[model samples]
Target chain A: MKAVVVGAGFAGSLIAKVLGDNGFRVTVLEAGTETGHDEAVHRFRTALVKSPLAPYRTTVAAPSSDYLINTGPFAYSSPYLRMNGGTGTVWTGITPRMHPEDFRTADLGRGRNWPISYDDLEPYYRAAEWEIGVAADADEQRQHVPVADGYAYPMHALPRTYLDHAVASVVDGQRIDGRELLITGTPQARNGVPVSGYRPDGHLCAGYASCVPVCPENAKYTPRRTQKRWSPHIELRTRCVVNRLHADEFGRVTKVSYQRYEDDTTGRHTRHEVEADVVVLAAHAIENAKLLLMSGLANSSDQVGRNLMDHPALLTWALMPQPIGPFRGPGSTTSIDAFRAGPERATRAPFRIELGNWGWGWSAGSPDSDTAEFVAAGLRGYALRKAVADRVGRQFTLQFEIEQEADPANRVTLSEDRDALGNPRPSIHYGLSDYVKDGLLAAKRVSDQLFELLKADDYTSYKPDEERYFEHNGEPLRYWGAGHSGGTHVMGASKHDSVVDQWQRCWDHPNLYAVGCGSMPSLGTSNPSLTMAALALRTADHLVSHRAEEVRCTMSKAP
Target chain B: MDAFVELSAELTGFSAEELRSTGLVEQYAELAQDATDAELIQLWYTGVWRGQIPSARAYAEGLAWKAVGVAPPGTGAPGFGSWEHRPRRSV
Candidate 1:
């Protein structure tokens, strides 16, 4: 059987690997050009602002940033790279699994419950861990989340930096809101010690402080690694954007139309078509919804591009009494998971406290910008030197990824705005509900108390006029995006309310599978990549088995 | 140079020996010949990630912000002036 997969990110690459391994002829379409490791490293080294999207910009495979138009009050701060490796190449590589209770949000009266539970995705999560080389101690994970017995991580957790050890020693076992705040190693997808030298373009993490912007050491697991593993069985095409899907009389997706761009400019492109027995839309949540809406397919419920969700992050930074060295290890190596799930979640959202090792890099630029300001101010000699050392050494930041519920009003729709390719830009409307605001307030209270405990001087503040700031309890609060986007094409048990089923198969089209984070009915307090990979793998398994049965039935009916 | 080394070691909690290994001392010695206290602080951190600074731990202390010739937070210093000349970045 012939299968066509769109988007070569984490979900698409893994699904293609599975389908190819299952004896299906696979053709993977990637919108961006194939970005090699050395080029990315060179770009990162030469970039001025070392953001996550830095390495892939200005090149032929640049991200779709220049074309996007935001019409919402809260700008979509999360910028996505449209390269072959996709956003996975630039992620922080932290891979915390969703708590089992996260799957039961609706049952617990917090948010909508997933059609499938954590248990349903458990095996696939383990499979993804091995494939991605997750470094975590399963026993340590059991303290706050559920882990199956004998389900050890593929590699040992990366060593905590001296700063992490200091913070953990001070804050671990401290009670906050009736739960103890223990700083533990966050499960990460970066390479640690190898499991029997089974290296597939993988290397042990060497504490590169700029994991989000780029892993110069190539230690982080990107989808390019997945592509390498399955290259023998999969036919991969680069710079080909899947534009639309065509359905047969039986309401099954039979073919896909695409535009192959000659250059990075979206307008200069050639149109092409490919026929397939199975068509999978594994693009990111927003892009998947945009394509489906443009094709006029799989929107029978009028809910294709509704219910967008992201981990709206509220940031706090400070100077400690004693310097806990920052900007050494991964972007973040430890997190406080106390507030991830609990009874308090019903009224206010739950959050995870991610301690930044990059020292206010996300909020304010790091050592370079901080030092540059002093230089630009005309400070000279020892006085200037001392000022630079003091600020750079004492810097630290805390990021609270506060959860947002799936509000249908906060959605993605086709805008009147069009890109160079004449495709409509994704029109998004996003706002913070009182539930999320209360969570931010609670997180702020906890942060204030924690800083006091550590004797850290608080330097955190926000602009009053910022659109992200909201008046709550007569106090203004602010937030930013954590770059996690989901819920655009929500899945559910029924066709009336959702776009896909639990397996991510479109309800309106039999042969269409709209995989990726788009199918997530609700996002638990975890990064959506691992969960999306698990779901995509499960979908691939479902397709292969079901397709085999159909083929067998046809053969039996034939002479 | 010796005074800066001792101060950085005290603030960063790293010994002077470890600090010297980062090879920042070479740059420090060069800057010390002519650099003012504020300039010394600024130059050290500017080279922190580039392997000019001894260690990441020492860089985080940011004691230079309290040093002379630096403008107060937010306020730009008038060529080698104090923080009073510059607006504060935070309270």
Candidate 2:
């Protein structure tokens, strides 16, 4: 059987590799061009902003900017890179598992509950961890995340930075609400202690301190790496944008038509069609919803592009009373899960506090801004030396990504604006609800207390003039996107409320499946990539089993 | 120009031709802003290759100061301890 995957990102890459290994011919169509690690590194070195998305789109060509078109009261400032590896290429590499309480959000009186439970996805999560080469101590993780028995992570946890050790010392064993606070090492995709004898240029976190735009040392795992293992079996077609998906009278996806860009600069392209037995849409949350809505294929439930969700984060930065050291390790080495779940979540949103080791890189430009300020003050000689040392050493930042309830109003819809290939751009309408605002206030309270405990001077720059700013307890607070997109084409028990089934199969189309964060009914406090990977792997197993049953029934009919 | 290309080729494992193909010469020149590519590459060879950066923060601070024409002390030359301190190709 032939399988057509319409993305080359995290989910698409994993699903395609699994299907190829299962003896099905897999063809992946990527909308972006194939770029290597060298090009990404070159762009990163020269970038002015140093934002995660900055390096990927250095050229202002039409095809480069065709990916996202934001129209909103709140700007979607999070950079979404369109490349062979997808947004995973620019990810911060934090790989925390969703808590067990996350799956039963509705049962616990929080957000909507997922169709599948944590137990159902536990084995698949283990498989994903091994496949992606996650570096984490399973024992340590069990204290923070819920882990099943007989499942150990691929490698030992990464070494905690000085900043991490400092924060953990203060927060460890401390009780918040009802549960004890644990600041443990973050499970990351970046190399720490490699389990797979696979050595690349970027083998381990050499403390590049730049995991956002690109990891200089190829230590991080991207879907693009899997293409090497599954190449002979899987065929990847870059610059092939699958715009239209066709279904037959039986409501099964028969074929898909795509536009292939020959030259990105001139907007030149050729149209092609391909037939497949099974079609999977593994585009990121926004793009997956946009593609389905544009194709008009799986909208029988009218819930395809509704209920968009993201882990909306409130950024808080501060200065340590003493030089604890910053701007040394990865983007974030550890986080506090004290506020992830509790009795308080019933009236407010739950949250995870991510402690950044890269200092004020999330808020103010660290090292760069800190140094510039010293220079601008006209301080030179030994006085300048002492001041720069003091400021840079004490820099620290804390980011709280609060879980937002899936709301139908915040969604992705096709706009009148068309890209180079005439495909409608994804127009988004996203906003924060009172549920998230309450969570923000709770997170703020924790931040205030943590500053006092750590003896860190809070330097939170909450400007009152910004459009996205909101007054919380007389203090202006602003929310930022955590780049964890979810809930656009959510999955549920039936077609009445959701677009996909528990197995991520489209309820309207038998052979059609929509995978990725888009299928998540509700996003938990942790990053969504790990959960998305588990779901995709589970869907891959289901498809192989379903195909086996089909072959068995066909043999019986041969008589 | 030839000396800079030769030194970069020796240090970064990339041949002079390969460095040219990546357009690093042009990029390095642009980053140096006013300084020639030769001066910038020489600076990297002396500071980064010789291991002069005290810390990651120092490296970033040095680069930021250099952008505005201020050079941090204890440097051999103008380009030493700049942002383009790492080997052209880390891989």
How displaced is residue A319 in candidate 1, in Å? 1.4
- lDDT string for model 2 (A383-496, tens) is 544555566566778989899888888878999988767878788887777888899988888888888878898888778676468776676779887888888888998788
Give the TM-score of each candidate: 0.85, 0.85
Identify the CAPRI category of the predicted complex in candidate 1: incorrect
Q: Which residue pairs in model 2 clash with each other? A: A202-A217, A202-A218, A202-A219
RMSD after CA superposition, every candidate: 8.2, 8.0
lDDT of 2 at A311: 80
Q: Residues A1-559, candidate 1, lDDT per residue (tens digit)? A: 8899998888999999988998889999988876667676666554545567766743333346555567776776777778887888778788988888778777764557788888889998988888888988889998887788977788877776555666777888888778888888888888776555445355566555557766766678888888878946689998888888998666867789988877764468888999988889987888999999999999999889888889988899988765555555566778999999889888888889987766777777755676668667865444555665567666778899888888788788888976666677888887778888898999998899878877888988777876566668987678887778888888898998899999899999877899988888777778888888888889988998898765664355446
Residue A527 local lDDT, model 1: 83
